[model samples]
Target chain A: MTPPSGPRKGRPRNADADGAILAATREALAELGWGGLTMGDVAVRAGVAKTTLYRRWPSKNELVVAAVAEQLDELEMADLGSLRADIEAVVAQFASLLSAPETQAALLALFAEATRDPLLRRRVREAIIEPQKRLVLAGRAAAQSRGELPLDTCEETASAAVDIIFDTVAGTVVHRMLVSGEPATPDWISSFATLLLAPLAGIGAGT
Target chain B: MTPPSGPRKGRPRNADADGAILAATREALAELGWGGLTMGDVAVRAGVAKTTLYRRWPSKNELVVAAVAEQLDELEMADLGSLRADIEAVVAQFASLLSAPETQAALLALFAEATRDPLLRRRVREAIIEPQKRLVLAGRAAAQSRGELPLDTCEETASAAVDIIFDTVAGTVVHRMLVSGEPATPDWISSFATLLLAPLAGIGAGT
Candidate 1:
């Protein structure tokens, strides 16, 4: 329902409206693409007034970033028994997410736009990239607890290792599915998991 | 010089004009971005008639793919004496290219557009993705020759390995540089190269 008047900055935001608006943003992106998606259309789709949408998201870029972030939030890493199994599960999850039509349509466009706009780039990194790296962090902790990975003595080296692992896993899947135009099939995921585990095991051994 | 008339389908294309047009396209992408670039602007920048530009590339997608492919073509892998050295060199080279303003501006946008357009996706793969995999293949062969990596006996398995390696190398660099908004500096490259070598050595040993 449209608020009688737009809520003030401190007013409690409507969780329903937030959900609807983000869902509508993703729907519009899938149907209309990045160029065709507009704030007004998203508002109409969400059954909210333009002012309500604008009051929440200042611009289309911010709205789309939030929508994409919400989708990425669905990615959860369960502690599979082994490090290899955990890697495979997460890789499969990420591939499936990227394969979604809305994500397929929105992500690269967002990254492209972020290239020229510093504010938008920071927003994207904060909202999407940074949040997703938590999966890597969590997975690493789980692996270490299992004794599959060794604890790093040097904080700097440990931090850098997380960055490398995150980049490799996320980047490899995105490239295989999007850039290379290949399917991230079950067999492929298994092989990739094996490939990843090798390097990870090496890190654990401090090689 | 402008052709007296647009070259016929069978006539030889002007190499200089082709080069100038592609260069102009990159310049426009860096300055105007994908949304703002136009065929007319590219023609003017190339000092060629619009017809000539159109004759070679029927659409903006085709033209952009060609321009991006030309940039990717510059990437070559030399036998840097060891797999680690070779991987590091190619990774550094790819990162530098992705760092350029025009590539930063154009690549993700092109990939995003290709998500929906099948023909453009094919062109991107044929011109850019497929060709770049050669570097991975060549590097693998070189490593095998040096006894740093084992040769695969199965064609299917070997092909899959190439795909995985290519995706890991390119995707990681692209994600680190573009999506994560982090510099793929020398220190990062060394860590990445070391990580890559471990798994590669495992694969060579038939693990």
Candidate 2:
């Protein structure tokens, strides 16, 4: 049974196999955490050859980025008409996504590891951060269109707000999750969202 | 001379040792980063002893917390009687302080580590967060008196904004420092200050 073509013909390369591997990575990250994750473990958990796993990703960080991207791509951004509504809607929903228990655990590890490694940091920015940044930038654009925010409103500022929401919630919620054995609730996200988003709506103008 | 144990002994614990140790901690944190710091190192740097250091503080986190506190405490809070002025002044200065390379590295390490260690997190919260919370609350109170930010504006949201600002500037600035080796300067801090504080004053009233 000789394989033909360029890097192909390997038991038909099951599409679902990639998905399962990612899911396993997510589970392992949640269960064992960042420092504990290993390619050998992921391979065993995925029922794949260590060679097969390495063929797909060169490093553990690569595997982590793939897992993050796949899990996160499923989260769609809201597109409410106005910037205020857009920000509010996105923030409201983001509150839920960010506070997800498994994701929270994985992200805590990612952020922590990023403190020590530069390559991993770039992967996070690329695989996880860029997409989220696009959403934030889109919301900022909507706000400008609705005339709620100044045209010159630095998207970076608004973008920073979104980052803040996730980071703080990540920090705060992870603290709660580890200590209390509970996921961060949506209500908590909503509370933080309102705090950060209100400024964009120009609500305190007269004041 | 094991005598004279009324209150304490050995040079009576020089009042300036605390300040000197804190200075040494900052210097070490800036030069070697957090992972490189130790009570022994701090003692050696400060011209003290391992025993004297332990007598004063228990752990590296505690020592770093003290250093962080000293630098941060010296900064003035903006209770300028106007929410706009108050927030601008307080946060502007915070961004400035965080912008410093040594301060940024030390604090980020402390905070990032806090995500994993509960005790350190608690100490950081106690020393840094509570006072900042008071500042935000007092600013809110000032707004209340002057009828600026709505009474209904979520306090957590307001606080999260502060948290986001602190962490984002830290993350972004440090990311830049690590990437570019450029020290965050007063100019960068002032620009960030102008971007956030000016818009933030409009918070509660928006949408």
Candidate 3:
């Protein structure tokens, strides 16, 4: 039952299994939810042995985090010529992720588990949140370059702005989508963008 | 195990049981977490019959949601004269709630469960989220009176502003406390209030 491949060249086959496993995880989440989802079921759906899945992901938390992180990898930050547009596009993308039935369900489940498990929380933060935060950083830098956001007086101030901006942008989307159970509609996104950019515009225009 | 009391006048006994049950739930959440917690164990902890607990709360989700709602009832929005002080105070209060091990754990667990259970979601919205949103409406109204937030042009615009403000305020506090793993310090709360009110202040001042 040994693989006829070297450790260095295990990417192709492993990639296929990983893809299938993640897809199966999503399917399981959609059907069974986090409480009912089992590694054995996921492996069955993935057409892999339970041992294979266990080898790759030691626990359900690890598997779900990996699956969600893979999904989050699709979030892209394109330079959309303006900060408002860029922010809106990212917001829209995030909204879509939150609106998806399986992803939202799975993401919340991971968050719940993370609250009890420090290691799982760290994994989720690193794999899911940290990458998206880079998009925030990039957008801020772009806004500064476009003369939309003022350059902070000090590094401390800059970091603080980034933290505030990150929480404002990301947190609002989550609240609107999940907490309020409201759709992040185009009109809503536009209104949010306007509200978000108002202060930045004022600062940029020296108001 | 019949009590020597009139069936119609069971308020005192029920209230005592409710308090004991909620306290036991928090203790169980702190010890066993959401995954490990069960109604039977909680009933045992509360020194109540399993049937008594089940008759009151049909499931763990319902029980936990009720227990957490009791905690959330403490989130009062007192008017501290100014929008800034009011917001900072509420933010401080919310930070304290999230910092509590039992409440944070239970809140996230309920949120996760509600993702799949529509009934549970409705209960949570009604009992937890909707009630807190009143504070947003009140704060906005106060800001308008104080010439901090401009008066809305129409009812629709006013509702939209409330939604925006609610999401911004609640979402940012959650992000700071839960996601960023940062304390909502006094200075941090003050800065957050200032950042939040910046654009609104401009509109109010006609800048």
- The candidate that achieves the highest TM-score relative to the unseen native structure: 3
List model 3 lDDT by residue over A98-153, tens digit each: 89877877877777777777887898888888788888889988888987777868
lDDT of 1 at A143: 86
| Of 1 and 2, the candidate ranking higher by DockQ | 1
Cα lDDT, all candidates:
0.83, 0.59, 0.80
Writing each residue's lDDT as its tens digit, candidate 1 over B1-207 gives 235787678768777989999999998887777766889999999999999887887778888888888898999998878888888899999999988988977888788778777777888888888888899999999999888777789999899788888888899999888888789899899878867776667544422
Candidate number with the higher DockQ (2 or 3): 3
Q: Model 3 chain A, poorest ten-residue lDDT window?
A: A1-10
What TM-score, to 2 decimals, does candidate 2 have? 0.60
Q: What's the distance in Å from true for residue A182, model 3?
A: 0.7
Error of 1 at B18 (Å): 3.6
DockQ of each: 0.56, 0.11, 0.53
Docking class of 3: medium
Q: Write the per-residue lDDT of candidate 1 for residues A1-207, one digit (tens) a residue.
A: 235677777767777989999889888877766666778899999999999988877778888888888898999998978887788899899999988878877887788778877788899998889888899999989989988888878998888788888988898899888788788899999878777776667644422
The candidate that achieves the highest DockQ relative to the unseen native structure: 1
Summarize candidate 3's per-residue lDDT along B81-181 as a digit string, tens digits. Answer: 78888888888988998898787678777777787788888999999998888888888788779876668789987777777888888888876667667
- Provide the lowest-lDDT 10-residue window in model 2 chain B: B173-182
Total backbone clashes of candidate 2, pairs 3 or more residues apart or in separate chains: 7
Q: How displaced is residue B111 in candidate 3, in Å? A: 1.1
The RMSD (Cα, Å) of candidate 1 is: 4.3
lDDT of each residue in A103-171, candidate 2, tens digit only:
655665554444445666677777776676666657666666766667765657655466544443333
